[model samples]
Target chain A: MKRRISLFGALREADARGYIEVDVPAHSTIAELREAVQHYAREHAPAISPGLIQRSAFASGDEILHNHRSVPEQGELAILPPVSGG
Target chain B: MTEIYTAVVDIAHGPLRPAEALEFVADPRFGGIATFIGRVRQHNLGRVVTGISYDLFDALALRTFQHIGERARQEVGGPMKLYIAHAKGDLRIGDFAVVVAAATPHRDEAFRACRLAIEAVKHEAPIWKQEHYIDGHSAWSEGCSLCEEHRAEEQRAAGLAATQAGDAHGHEH
Candidate 1:
């Protein structure tokens, strides 16, 4: 399945739209999605690191998803890097 | 009679208005009001910061603010009003990035609630800050250690759970 993940913070520098789209296996869990994204980053986005992707959290709508949770089939989700708001 | 205000939370794209926050928290019956404004500074980590751009997960950020307000009110144990807002886009040095206001019947509760509100926003909100430097370079600010702390705590908990399960299943050499 193809998923578009919105990016923020330092991750925004990876792409002009502040987001990236990657293909994942059907019914992929967040942990699997993280691996896919890390692979994508390595090949395409030098600014982002696999370690950062490992630490980043995925959010579906307003709720943050745990690693074991499955990615939804519809709509876009966000990839939240460690926050720095004041 | 005007309806009593409990909490007002927003993620604004334009400039944040401190005056509006003050006005929202104002009440004749309340004896004290406290406000905290966080502004973009010119210097950070010994580097000159020309400006900053703030990003947010809007829905989650607003929900976090409301939870902070409710928690503050519960902990302070008083009639309280809160106003919280954070900027969402590019801002120059000296521009306000966030504002928190609280009003309570007593000075102590007002102060405590205001402090709690701001601190919670700083730690819990899903917002990010990217600072632009004078050398035509930019970097995201090093965020608070809360995320790392949370991860550490989770690891500890998982370790404990695994140990307990091992104990139940009999130790393996």
Candidate 2:
């Protein structure tokens, strides 16, 4: 299965791309997705700072999840870095 | 139109109107309405800011707004009307950047809900800002630190609530 991740804020800057698709085994943990994202970033967007991913937060739907949480079988995972708005 | 619990969330390209925000939450049942307006400033972090451009992830941003509205309603323990709107694209200094309005039966709940909703939108909404400076250079800001503060406060409050519940259970035993 493929999990689509949407990037925003610093993570979008890091990816240099808005959307990323990662093929994964079913019910893959968020930790795994993070690793895949890191690897993808390294390969596709070398100019982006490495530390941005370390500071990122992931959200599935309305719930922000820890690294240990399981990624749903199908949904867009939003990669959010620190936000700034009023 | 008027409604009891209005949830207005939009990421707009044109200018934002404070009157629209005020109108969204207008209701006779509420004695108080609290509003917060964020405007683009002339300077930031020592740089003479000329203007700002906002970029947002639309679908996720709207979902986050809905989430924030729901949380505010739950926090107040009843129906509450909310209006959250943000500007996208380039905006000049002194223009309204964001508006958050909340209406409840009393002043306290309205204030609390408005505060929480704005903070949540700042912390959770997938919005990015780039400030253009008078030096002919622009840079993306590091984002608001208040989000971290809000998270820590929530954690502390949850811990306190849990401890109180535990103490009550112990007393019962």
Displacement of residue B33 (Cα, Å) in model 1 is: 1.0
* Model 1 chain A: worst 10 consecutive residues (lDDT sum): A54-63
Report the backbone clash tally of model 1. Answer: 0
Cα lDDT for residue A83, model 2? 65
As for candidate 1, its clashing pairs are: none
Evaluate model 1: give its TM-score.
0.82
B1-173, model 1: which lDDT tens digit per residue?
A: 32123222333435788998889888887889989999999998788999988888787777778778889979788688888888888888898888888888888998999888887787667888888999999887655322343456544655755566642111110
Model 1 agreement with the true structure over A2-68: per-residue lDDT tens digits = 9999988878877998789999989999889888899899999977877667667788666777788
Clashing pairs in 2: none
Over 4 Å off, model 2: A14-17, B1-13, B144-173
Number of the top-ranking candidate, with DockQ as the measure: 2
Candidate 1 CAPRI level: acceptable
Q: Which prediction has the highest lDDT against the true structure?
A: 1
- Model 1 misplacement above 4 A: B1-13, B145-150, B153-173
